[model samples]
Target: MRTDDVLEVMNELVAFVRVAEAGSFSAAARQHGQTPSAVSRQVARLEKVMGVALLQRSTRQLRLTEAGLDVLERGREMVAAAQATVRVAEGHVGVPRGRVRISAPKAFARQVLQQPLLSFLQRCPEVDLHLMVVDRPVDALREGVDLVIRLTDDPPPGMVARALMPVRQLLLASPAYLSGRPPVRTPEDLMAHSCLSLGEQERDNRWRWVRGGDVVEVAVSGRYTVNHSEMRLAAVEAGLGVGCVPDFVARDALAAGRVVQLLPDWVFDNHYQGTAYLLFAASRHTAPKVRALIDHLVAALGPCAQPV
Candidate 1:
């Protein structure tokens, strides 16, 4: 085949795969800067070339046939390979440009990462960022994200995880709450106090404390149990109860003397204790935009981590 012929075929395959992944030609068209009719024609041309029906279309929805499913499964890899090839070539010849999509939990992104991301964009003039704040771990490939910032001890399989920082949660109480109460000297001391905690996990009600290689779980009850870390912090600030909260969330309050760290020698562990990592496809490591963002994250946030 001629060079143009190969390029044409690849383009058609890219279009078809995008439509399959998006579940609608219109969505694919919007993503790729094409009209739905044009995208539909590309898929039609690809089907003709392959001599098979690739999709079953109706007014309300689009479904893939067996042949279409086969094409989609294989074609996605080809599209990725092609994108990687382009990124590699761009890495060699040009400054990092184009949009970099990132997926992260909303509260964390807003509370901690927002300012840093803005600082990064200010420094890197050629780079554009698309931030998606999601509560759950998103499929990077399916979501078309360049990176995912996740708080996890074990990252998902088949991705490169660079630990940006170790997350530390500490037991804390407002100075007001601690003023008249008996001093907490040990794990057992917490038994007499109301402990605000996360309600989502069984482990939340059963608080874990670590001190000098000794770990203990205490079954504690609370007047308030919340799913959000900030809420727990709020309850603690209001002198409701002692709560487990990350250092980042409590740092400002601690500095301001609004809240004091309880059991200073003991470390509190929660569901996301291990680390915050920047995850990406291994193939995209050489992409300059990915490298730039990772560098910024490491430089800005890594040093702030409290020692584990």
Candidate 2:
């Protein structure tokens, strides 16, 4: 191969690696601050130079072929090596001063992360902060978000993910509603009650309740359906029906008696609550801004930052 041909192929390899990690060109572009169309063209050009197919693309999804996956694994190592070479030359630079973009769920952004983040920004005026509230998982590199806060049972592959805390989901209803209906003392009791459901695509309306070693899945029906957590909470508070919600969202309300917990002995199991995570690219692991934000979040969330 010609020397220039090899160099051209290497560049394509980098683009391929980015696309694979991001899962879409649009996401990769957001990370790199380029247009989605531009990202597509670059990936296409790289494929042409390499004389191999890399990605299988459709309107809704992008998948990596065998060759693409191979390239992605090797390419990440190569990129890390290249970054290490630069870091060694530049040495450590203290005090991160730059913009940091973070992505989180809409409800979380408003109820959990917003205040603490504002405090973080106030303390570090030199650091510009960009926050994006999203309901679905976002590709950190593709969406141009420096970091992502995810509530998941498992982290995605090929990224550095730190668990923040274990979250619990609670089945709750307003006291006004529960006053008229029979108390929910067992999973079977829930069948007689109406339950507001969230997430339009959710197929199972069964609620899980676990006590000791025993678990029960209670089938529930309701007149209300909403995709937003806040709306669901509002409906439950309005005495529409019992709704399962995250502890963070319901904590204050529960304490204030605005909503009462049902079946305190039983906990949700199948959609077993897991830890929240702050995920970022391995490449930016040592960047000053990245390090500072991670430290700040860890401190803010406290014991939530368990190892791994």
Query: On residues 226-261, what C-alpha lDDT tens digit does candidate 1 reach at each position?
Result: 877788889999999998877778888889988988
Clashes of each: 0, 6
lDDT of each: 0.83, 0.80
Off by over 4 Å in 1: 1-93, 303-308
Ten contiguous residues with the weakest lDDT in model 1: 299-308
Predicted structure 1, TM vs. truth: 0.67
Task: State model 2's lDDT.
Answer: 0.80
Task: Give me candidate 2's TM-score against the actual structure.
Answer: 0.67
